[model samples]
Target: MKMRSLIATALVAALPGVACAQEVTLSFAHWLPPTHPLQPTGFEPWIESIKEASGGRIAIDIYPAQQLGAAADHYDMARDGIADIAWINPGYQPGRFPLHAIGELPLMMSDAKSGSRAFDAWYRTYAPEEMSDVYYCMTHSHDPGTFHSKEPVRTPADIAGKNVRPAHATMARWVSLMGGASVQVPAPEAREAIAKGAADMITFPWGSIFIFGIDKEVKHHLDTPLYVSSQAIVMNKDMVEGLPDDLRKVIDDHCTPEWTEKVVSGWVDAEAAGRQRMIDEGHTLYKPTAEDLAAWRESAAPLTEEWMASVNKRGIDAQAAYDAYVASLREAGALMGEN
Candidate 1:
């Protein structure tokens, strides 16, 4: 019978190579809080090392707290694919990522694995025109950032008229250049905007104000590493161009810079063990005084001269990318506080 129609046309040409060898989850979205430690110690052990280097054919379905949307819409939900991977922050959209605010300047690099390997090697030298669309997969920072107040701010005249909350937009223009009043929420609504007082001080990081419970509604903690929050993890560029080149080289061998210093030094050692469990749950932590941290670093020196005139009006080379990100954090000794 024509050899049974040539073995049913070779099983219909091997059914699209057995449906392209099946298995491929992805999804990922983020906005923290899956009992955050950037989710059980940084994206569940980097999604189990990209499902054991893709032999399991890649799988990952995260979608933490924001469950796939708001936290400033996770970099446009991974540039509109609505999440094939996200976790972005890029200072939660301020001026749409102004050169990732040089790892949110101020007192840069103290931890978060050498400021996430010097802001993922200086934002991969401007990620194809500052992160072209998507697929950028690394860049991290967050271990510094202070004043989780309810009072006791130390200096900069105790952050003048309060109502703070900053976290992005250069700490909301360094809390409107040290005179507070910048309230823009979103760190999971900053513990209900500082427990319904509608914010009186937030600017977190370093145990993320008790991983977003805002340390049971603030009581003051300025341990002073003030400023660091320039995250990224993007993916969806047509889902990494519809992967498969060996699961896109196991997502480019776990999108590295040595896995951005092993997933930001395990979320900066879980923000130094959540700031020593908010100083053993007592929480009035303070610690400033080097002349009140030099008057809060001279009131944050005009936020690094207005972030080098907004990265030299976008032409960039903002002081050679801030002196090669402080000489790659003093060649990775991880030069903490007092720049």
Candidate 2:
């Protein structure tokens, strides 16, 4: 024990920064537990990449598995400077991120990369103003949401009366429009809800199917594309403002609007991993027929108009934001794997 301690002390002494230098350690908190393989292989690599890119002068302390608080409380935590940084799901607190929720509208994303690009593009084109409080780093989604249900959802009518968890308010509305009872719950909490008969199914990025152990509770996964909800990594304004210009530039370089799409591609990868898990666990995966998709689209259309009206009541130019999002989606379509 003494020899081991001596070696540790010697190593710390050998590294000037490791010894007595009070390295400015920035804390980054997220809701996922460290055991989620996606973090070490995916999100954690981004951390390592930034550190290597910065030559270790800046160190980030990552707190995952909701070490700080519940998922829904993360945004309030970040806004209040509970931590230097965090990845927050805007949908977790519905009213606070009213405008940013536009990304969650139906069928806006096709794949993670394009969805991310489209999300980044959408944020730039329509909702940059919504993120003024924090240093907004990126906007992206899980690959694309799909239905993990107690029963197969191969047809539109299957949604009727089922307790489905939707990604956003609009999604919940969409479910309700199609006759499902949309429940709003954090994905982390969805597993227990399903196992305990609290929720019948959920529409989320495929990853939650595995991350939250939904495969064991739900036997079927709908193969049709659902809209992607935007999630972001943000830094407290005070911490961001205090950074040296060079260090700030480093963050800027890494967290670029374009780089954001690249960095967040993990979400899609995580979703894919979840889908594969579903297959491995013997869950039935089904795709809706063309006629069924048409039925879904027709049923869900009114929710879009309803969203516009709600956003309009919030005093921003709803038409402009809506139009911009639609236009950006059209432009983002090719990138999103749409013809």
Q: Which one wins on TM-score?
A: 2
Clashes of 1: 1
List candidate 1 stretches off by more than 4 Å: 1-36, 39-42, 45-57, 60-98, 107-128, 137-225, 234-239, 244-273, 276-278, 281-284, 287-294, 297-299, 316-339
Candidate 2: 10-residue stretch with minimal lDDT: 1-10
**What TM value does model 2 have?**
0.86
In model 1, residue pairs whose N, Cα or C atoms come closer than 3 Å (at least 3 residues apart or on different chains), thus clashing, are 145-227
Q: Rate the local accuracy (lDDT) of all candidates.
A: 0.77, 0.72
lDDT, candidate 2, 1-339, per-residue tens: 123434654666688666432124577888887876547765677777767766674677788988988888776677678877788888777666767777777765676666566666667643456767778777766677877888878766888879987877777878887788977777777888888898898887777677777777888888766677777788777777766676676677766556766666665676777777777777798877777777777886786776677778878788888777666656766233365
Best by lDDT: 1
lDDT of 2 at 23: 27
Provide TM-scores for the models. Answer: 0.34, 0.86
